[model samples]
Target: MRLSMRARWALMFGGLFLLAGTALLLINYVLVNEIVPQAGLFVSNFAGGPGVSGGATVTAPPPVLDKQFFQKGVEGAVDTFRASAMQKLLIASGIALVVTGVLAALLGWWTAGRALRPLNTITSTAQRLGAESLDRRINLDGPQDELKELADTFDGMLDRLAAAFDGQRRFVANASHELRTPLAVQRTLIEVAMADPTATPELLRLGQHLLHTNERSERLIEGLLVLARSDQGLVSRVPVRLDEIVDAVLRSSAAMATEQGVTLASDLEPRVVMGDSVLLERLVTNLVHNAINYNEDGGSVLIRVGDRPALLVSNTGPEVPASAVPALFEPFRRLNRERTASRDGAGLGLSIVRSVTHAHHGIVYANPNHGGGLWIAVDLPLLERTMTSLSPRPGADPAISRG
Candidate 1:
């Protein structure tokens, strides 16, 4: 049977006690029965010996001492001594075994718990862990034993994970910025070509199409950079109104929604949160844009907000499978597997939304609408204090920073 560590220790101590007690008892028994009273036996034999004469056999007169009685006394003394020693040994062993067994059990339990304390710490650290909180460590203090080595190994793993995430974020940011410069130049050239007065109808159409494609590429690159930055960590926290941010994003997206013949509706209750306003605004914008972009003609979008710093955006559009809803938040994952030359979206909208939500320590969920379209909800921590002064404008340039 595989006993627990504490149980094993207890059994070990108990076995040692039993073995030592048995050995000591046997030694005492042997000495009392075999070695002691040898002098009394010699005296009894000398006194009881028959006398021998030359030629004729002669019997010696009985000694003054009662030989039989004296011998019996000597034998009785030895037997009594042996019996007394055996009784005392048994009593002492019983008492000692009970007392020491209890002490051993207690000590074993305490030692086992103390030894496994670091393991418990490691387990809790692993349980509470997430991608953003990779800096947490067991940093166990004490002798460099096996448990300490295990804790140190776990801390090293976390260090490696943190480094990998940082490297990935850096790569994404650099690539996005590098991609944006050429895209800007391309947009400028295409605009100049579109401005040419003598351009044929086909040339004008081609220039307009190129401009749209370049814009979509720019949006995709920017979304990637934003997603990377959000994953890196939140840099600053300021009071932000969910309603105000949503309203602002709605305003920016108003023209696009109108052009698409999508109706916008909102139930913006006062919901204030503490986070990076730019990222929060971007998050809302992404959700709203996705809702607007993937809707049917004359469809409607409902934006609802609550005091819990919660927001839910539901829209009417094509039927979305429940199984496919989760993959919608992945970067560059579109509903259509066949990548047609559609500039409608670059498919990073929901992905950016999810990243920003995570950076702010929030929960986001998505459900496919009953008939058609998608429903997205986000919940963030609410700020306790109401703002009396005007908040800073959220037009700051996006930048990646170390956590």
Candidate 2:
């Protein structure tokens, strides 16, 4: 039902070519009909009969009567000759036109292919373009035309995009140091004040609260920086054991889980995925942290790694509405929660998870649990080498949930 650009172009060119040929063929036929004499053009038809006119048993040639009869005969014979000649001419011309029209169509197809060659190059380049490879350009070289203008415009847009990302990357790179130092200093000051021997109970309580606030601020800033970095995409990729990363994240997250009165469990399979190890760890860490922090006391967090996708994290918490599940992956949506009442999140955990997963060309899916809480699954691409070498007992669990 739908035609590709190349096919459409070829068809258009062929149709126009056929139309011109048809017009020329008709014009030639018409001209021949108009220029030729309709009567008395052929003298051969009026030649004298052999011997003399005969009758009865022998057939005889037509006998001329007066001048009017002779003129009428000549006109009739000439008309017959003209009609025969024109019919032959029309048949021959029609055959030639058909043959040439086919050739013209073939030529149009080839020409269309050649004309669209640059578009193929642009398409392939765009398909491979990534945040890390934004310096690429079509750089089509030819006479100034629409396609040339299009490529140049795309290149210019990429240039501007590359510059803007570079600026954001610079800010994220420096932010880890510049932004965190002050928060660290504030935390240290608060701790020192609370440790003072002469401090009253009231003062110590105030200092302790200040310290908690400072730590929360630090977390918020750190999450923002990670989110920003991940958005720029991975700078490089290497094979990393996703199971191992989950294990490490759980170990680090155990204390937080205990503090929140939540239990941590895992079912890790030996699965390898391609991505930056650091970013992958951050992705797992965020998933685990969110699982623990959002749940009620005595709730449990379960993490699993298997074939297809590298990771899945699930936890029991307050019942999440099915309609409101999409907001979990959104950054700063947690801000609304904090504004109303204090929570242990800066609202960037799942945002980081989604961002890092996308940077690695992976997907995140999430849904509300039947009982309560959420079921989040991350489907990351596995290397063929790893998949064939040590295939997991099998699962590319559907996009059930994301943090």
Candidate closest to the true structure, highest lDDT: 2
RMSD of each: 10.2, 6.5
Local distance difference test values of all predictions, in order: 0.78, 0.80
**Can you tell me which runs of candidate 2 are displaced by over 4 Å?**
24-99, 258-261, 391-403
Backbone clash pairs for candidate 2 read 365-401, 365-402, 366-401, 366-402, 367-401, 376-401
Top of the candidates by TM-score: 2
RMSD of 1: 10.2
Candidate 2 per-residue C-alpha lDDT over 320-357 given as tens digits, one digit per residue, 9 for 90 to 100: 88777788788877623763233556777888989999
Tens digits of per-residue lDDT for model 1 on 152-182? 9999999999899878877976897689989
